[model samples]
Target chain A: MVIEKIKESRFTPDVFDITTFGTAFADHMLLSWYKDGKWSEPIIKPYGKLDFTPAISVGHYGQGIFEGMKAYKGETGDVYLFRPDKNLERLNKSAERLDMPQIPEEIFMDGLKALIDLDRQWVPSTYGMSLYLRPVMFATEEAITARSSNEYLFAILTAVAPNYYNKPLSVKVADRYSRAANGGVGFAKAAGNYAGSFYPTHLAREEGYDQVIWTDDATHTFIEEAGTMNVFVRINDKLITAPTSERILDGVTRRSMIELAKAEGIDVEVRKVTVEEMHTAHKNGQLKEVFGVGTAVVVNNYVAVGYASERLELEDLPETESYGKILKKKLVDLQMGISEDPFGWRLKVEENLVEA
Target chain B: MVIEKIKESRFTPDVFDITTFGTAFADHMLLSWYKDGKWSEPIIKPYGKLDFTPAISVGHYGQGIFEGMKAYKGETGDVYLFRPDKNLERLNKSAERLDMPQIPEEIFMDGLKALIDLDRQWVPSTYGMSLYLRPVMFATEEAITARSSNEYLFAILTAVAPNYYNKPLSVKVADRYSRAANGGVGFAKAAGNYAGSFYPTHLAREEGYDQVIWTDDATHTFIEEAGTMNVFVRINDKLITAPTSERILDGVTRRSMIELAKAEGIDVEVRKVTVEEMHTAHKNGQLKEVFGVGTAVVVNNYVAVGYASERLELEDLPETESYGKILKKKLVDLQMGISEDPFGWRLKVEENLVEA
Candidate 1:
């Protein structure tokens, strides 16, 4: 690996507002290229613009995939990455599904560690603040033909993020629009999957909802996802969510939340949770909460679900009584190094490891 | 409009092979930008690289759409575009579905004519050759947030093309994978929609088939598309094709062929064509032909179909008896200005229009 360190840092932690997520970037980034059936040596360089031909395959064909992760600064000044391996694993899965080349684990983990260690000061020290890392791979071949490109670019960009302070969400249960098909790329974090949802989400926002709760494409009855995150519906004391299928993303946060809930003695059922069941539970006063889990917000509670012409308003429970709140706190505490490492989910960034 | 002419022409039409297709581009290209709430003035400049941040929204979220068109060199040394308006209409429809800003008609038409006029030498003069035009629009916002971009880049790139000499295709009837969903962006020429099909198409190719005959996502029993083109099945003498739906592309060539067939006194039926029906027709020796129509290949004949464990081999009729050949020749003749434009679909590219 070649390391080209930035001569001067451009980021000012004192003046930067972490809450404005995805706006500010760190001084350095990591890039690797896949060409001629192999990956080039990873390069660490200053964050800047890239020069590409207008006919690059990704621009016209959308053969791109990305992974979202975060790095937290512990109270003792140590930087912690929550399950970086999982991100790398999922990234490869997305690459395979999109017919792009797989990123080597060494290239992903080593490059990620070195870049974060080089820009360690960019990791926000506040309890809920972290560095949001976006690792994206896209076709870089300069061609207009609709085929899998032989050349690819893999890049990792980091931004400072603060705790989300937005209010609980009100989402519309999708009745006509669908996010994924039975055998589609929804299970992968493909760039096109997110692009396909923007218009539907915009329509929902215009209807006074924050986001959309995507349902099955074939039936539109079973819940699949909430916005870009895996959704969970709480009824009475049981937590229910759709099982991971080809049409639903297997989110790291969703998996972590389920484990955290199980360990906390909560009844978590991983099965198909239909919209009809949610409506029935709401009518019977058994539906307690609905939430979405992902890397960005960690867990976002949904206060209302709009289906057809009716809005089912969920009762907002106190923080102590909210399962979403409890699980989020537990997960956050574990991620932030404030709790014992029972699941070995956190990987520390050591200065010595960077040199090695 | 700003015109930055190239200092020297880079194309050598005498030495260039048009059959290579999309490998060589003309010297000049057109570009327009959408920022704030309006489109900037269109610019025609030397075809070159574009500078973009690695975090450009399209690279991560895939808000991209494109249109395919061709400019034919008439026998009298004039240029003509067949159904340019249809391409523009479909492009905007794709843009709307992908949540992109609509390109103005003037920008599309004026830029196309000016660019073609500027690079008139690049147009292949061979009888069966033309200039292929690719107009692509993508999100250019420098952010990783998964939302519709506020800024976009629209560009038109032209390449010399020759007649395709590919052999008749063998296709697989999709059983485990689908190209689109009931309520998805499949009908739009969205970049993501094509990216999602690369894997499934790759699998079909590995199975010794040239392309996939995508079936309905809900049932895998009804045919929707043949590869990226609109498909047609000829049972006896009547041409049958699936109606345009939320899952099938409204192909320009498909529409033209239907009209051409009707004008030739051939019966055409626009309805759902199921796989079982196709199988029964083949067993009864009534399935005369199956073909795909698109802007790229105009029309491609399918010689065989692999479904389940059986391969249904189609008889190759003589060129005179082939419906695809008959309609393709009629359409190509009208496009090349060798025949009368009965439908007024051919638009002459007047030299005066470039000055306007």
Candidate 2:
């Protein structure tokens, strides 16, 4: 691979702060081009403004997709990436849904690894601090027709940030609006899916809730997901989550937690979870914990669930031995290389790993 | 309004063709900036590229809204705009739905008229030709949080094009995927609303249809708009269409058509038209004509409607005395100043209008 490096660094590293997420960029970024049924070799260049006319298809027709993953530094000098292959697979899935060309494994994996390796100094060494990797693919063709563009631009950006959530969240059950519908692009991390969710989420925030728990678009009866994360509900000692479908995102974190719980001999139910059933469970004092799981925050505990005029409060779960805390600890330990790799989930970079 | 005019134009006049809808832009574009709770004075500059950082909110969270309108050249070298006030009003309404700042009437109207008058030659003089005006506004603030941005960029680009559709279209009734849900941004002319419909429309096109007639998300029972335009059904000499709600765009062309039909002694019914009702009407041989109305294409006749294994064909309506033909003619005549402006719909450009 022929990679181009900048002469001097333009970015100065600062302490990672969780409050300011996605605000800074590293000194360099990886960019690759696709045209005429072929992709050019990836190159790392200085992070600066890109030249794009106003008529780009991604700006008008919304044919952009992205993926979110993290790279962590272990206590000794080892660097690890948590299931990067899964994120790359999901990125291709999103591309397929948007009528875009699928990215090859060499470009998606090698480009990301090489970019991270070159900027290894940006990776934080402190505990619970990691580099957030954003891999984006968008249409670069300058036309306004309602069709897919032939030209595309793919790039990866990294930001060093701490954990997103510091406390448990309060959520409301959405009764009016929906995030995505049946047979829609909700499963993919399409850019437009995030855009339509802002207004409803803002309404929930004004109502003193941290986020909204979306239900199915057909009847608003069955639970779907939180806009940014997959949701999990605990009834009795069984963990119940909605199955991965066209209406729900196949989150990597959610999948890992499900695996960890089942491996620990816990009963995990991946079926249709209805809001009415959850209300009934809360009424009977059987619904114990509800948390949102995603790459940003592995497990965000929900302290209150509001539906209409009723509220189900589980304020004591954060301090207790809840599933969210347990799964979060296990997930972080595995990510930071503090615990044994039971399922071989961590992939070590070439330079940082010390041979046993 | 401290306007800035470009010293020279980089664009050359090109032939108007329907196939090249938004390919070429005119000489100058209108631009306005919003910051610190105020909008800057409008300006007109040479149509060129725009500088935006990768972290802009619109590219990440989708805080973008737009409006589509047109300008026509009259017989004696006069340029006219049809119902521009309504377009400006709808643009602000869309802004309100997306949680963005509303564009003041002075800036939106005055800036648009000034820009069009300065580039009057771009307005095609042929009978069925017009300059398509696209007014777009997007978030410009560089941040990653899922909230509204403090800065915004509003610009208008013009392209001379003939009618969008030359022949009547064949549309499919969406049975599985949805365009918008209840209490969503469907009515806002939002960019994301257009993005989500592309994949489903692509599927419909592969099945030999030009567009998809979106149904209500909850039941798929009631017929909504056709994703891009407002739909109308004519049964037994009466024109029936779905009422505008949060689920449908309140199109300016649709409102003009309704007024024109009422003036022509035609009964226009604005109510919920269910799929079952339309199917029964078609089966009983009462469905006469179906057309779509919007600013892009004044009135697009539907030659066939496909639902499941059934196809209701109306191929002969274009040659017959169909209401779509009559309404389209009336609209174009009124826009080009060939017919009297009964409702005062046409606004003449100040420099192009001759004193009567």
Candidate 3:
């Protein structure tokens, strides 16, 4: 591995804001090239522009995939990553679906740990703040053919993320626009999946909704995802979410939350939740809460859902009485190294991984 | 517009092969930038590499769209483009669906004409050859957030294309995988739509098939597309194809073929085509021919279709009796300037478009 450190530090965690969460980055980034069926030596260099041909495959064919993760700074000044292995595993799964090459475990793990350790100061020590990590891979071959490229680029970027104090959202249930098909790349974190949702999400925002709750493409009858996150609904003290399928992403935070909720003696059901059922539950005064879970925002509670011509507002609950709030606190505490991690989800960053 | 002419020419059309069709390029390419709520001056520059950040929105979120076109060299050394206006219109439609900025008609038309005229020497005069044009647009902003980019890049690239003599394809009818869904971006020429089909097509290739015939996402009950092309079926003396919908691409060549076939007094039906109906037609010896139409290949005949352990071989028809062959010859003749165009689809290139 080659290490090209930045000449000067640009680590300004104090000024980091949520609005520009991913705009600001750490001083260093990790890059690797795939060519001739093998990966080149990984390099950690200054975070800056790259030189490539405009004809690169990803620009025209969209063969790109990415993963989202974060490293938390504990009160003891130690940096830790939560479920980095899961992110890596999901990245390879996305690569397989997009017909791109798989990244080796050593390269992913060693490169990530080394990069994070090198820029450990960027991991903000402020309460409820952490460093957001973006691991992305894209086809780099300069060709115009509608096929997979022989060359690829894998990169990792880090940014200081602000504390997310998300307000309850008003979401629109999709009746026309579809996010993913039954046999599609939705399960994989493919770049195209996210881009395809932007126009629809824009429309939802125009309708005075914070985000869109994507439903099945075939009939638009059941909820699949809420924007880019996995959605969960609580009705009469029972939590239910759509089962992970080819049309739904298998989110790390979603699975963790499911386990955490089950551990707390809450009834958790992993099954398809239909829009009609939610509307009926709301009408019967049984719908308690609805929320989305993802790496960026651990939990975003939804206050209202718009289906057809009706806007069903959920009951407002205090933080102490809200399951979403309770679960997010428990998850955040474990991630920040303030609580016991019975699931072994946290991996402490070793400062010795890189040479001083 | 600024013109950065190449110091030397690399017009080697004689040795150009079909396998390296899009790999080689013309002398120059057209580039335009979109920033600050408007487009910058377009430039015609020498074909080369570009400088960009790996954090470009397209590399992470896949906000990319493209169009395929061809410039034919006439017998008298004149250049002609087949329906360039249609391509530009479709490109903007694709842009709108992807939440991208709409490309103005003048920029698209003027830039294309100037670029083709400047590289007119590269247009092959071979009997069955032409110059392939790729107009692609992508999000170029240096950001990692999953939203539409504030900046974009639009480029036009030209390549020497050899004669396409496609053999009869053996396709596998999809019962599991789907290409698009209702209210999706399938009708637009979005980049992600193509990448999502690579894995399924690779699987079909492994099963000794040339391509996979995509079906509807709901139940896979209706055939939608054959590989990346619009599919057609001839049941006895009638030509049938699926209508343009949110789940099917609005192919230019597909529409042209339908018009030409109708002009030749052939009955055409634009409706849904089901796999079961095709099987029934084959069993009754009523299925006559199956073909695919697109910008590339013009027309590709299908010899067999595999569906659920049954490989149904289509009846062989001579070129004289094949409707696809007749329509392709008429279209190619009109495009190559060998025949008088009655449909007014050909646009003659004027040498005065660019300065000497």
Query: Each candidate: how many clashes?
Result: 0, 0, 0
lDDT of 3 by residue, B242-329 (tens): 9988888889999899989988899999999899999999999999998888887788888899998899898778888999888888
Q: Model 1: clashing residue pairs?
A: none
lDDT of 3 at B354: 81
Q: What is the lDDT of residue A185 in candidate 2?
A: 75
Candidate 2 lDDT, A1-356, residue by residue in tens:
45666677654655454456666676667788889988888877766678766666666667778888888999986888999999999999988887778889988888788777877777887877788888888777876555678888888888776676677889999898877766567888887777777667778888889888998866788888987789999998999999998878999999999999898787899999999988999989899889999998778989898887687887466544688788888888899999999899999877722111
Q: Write the residue-wise lDDT of candidate 3 on A253-299 in tens digits.
A: 99999999998888999999999999999999999999989998788
Off by over 4 Å in 2: A11-18, A318-320, A352-356, B10-13, B318-320, B352-356
For model 3 chain B, where is the 10-residue window of minimal lDDT?
Answer: B12-21
* Interface RMSD of the candidates, in order: 0.9, 2.0, 0.9
lDDT of each: 0.88, 0.81, 0.88
Residue B124 displacement in candidate 2 (angstroms)? 1.0
- The ten-residue window of minimal lDDT in model 1 chain A covers A12-21
The sequence of per-residue lDDT tens digits that candidate 1 reaches over residues B1-356 is 78888999997757347456575788988999999899999999999898987898888999989988998888788998889999999999998888889999999998998888888878766776788899999988887777889899999998777544367889999999887887899889988888888898899889898888999887899989975688999999999999999888999999999999999999999999999999999999999999988887878888899888889999988878989888988988998999998999998887754442
In terms of lDDT, the poorest run of 10 residues in model 1 chain B is: B13-22
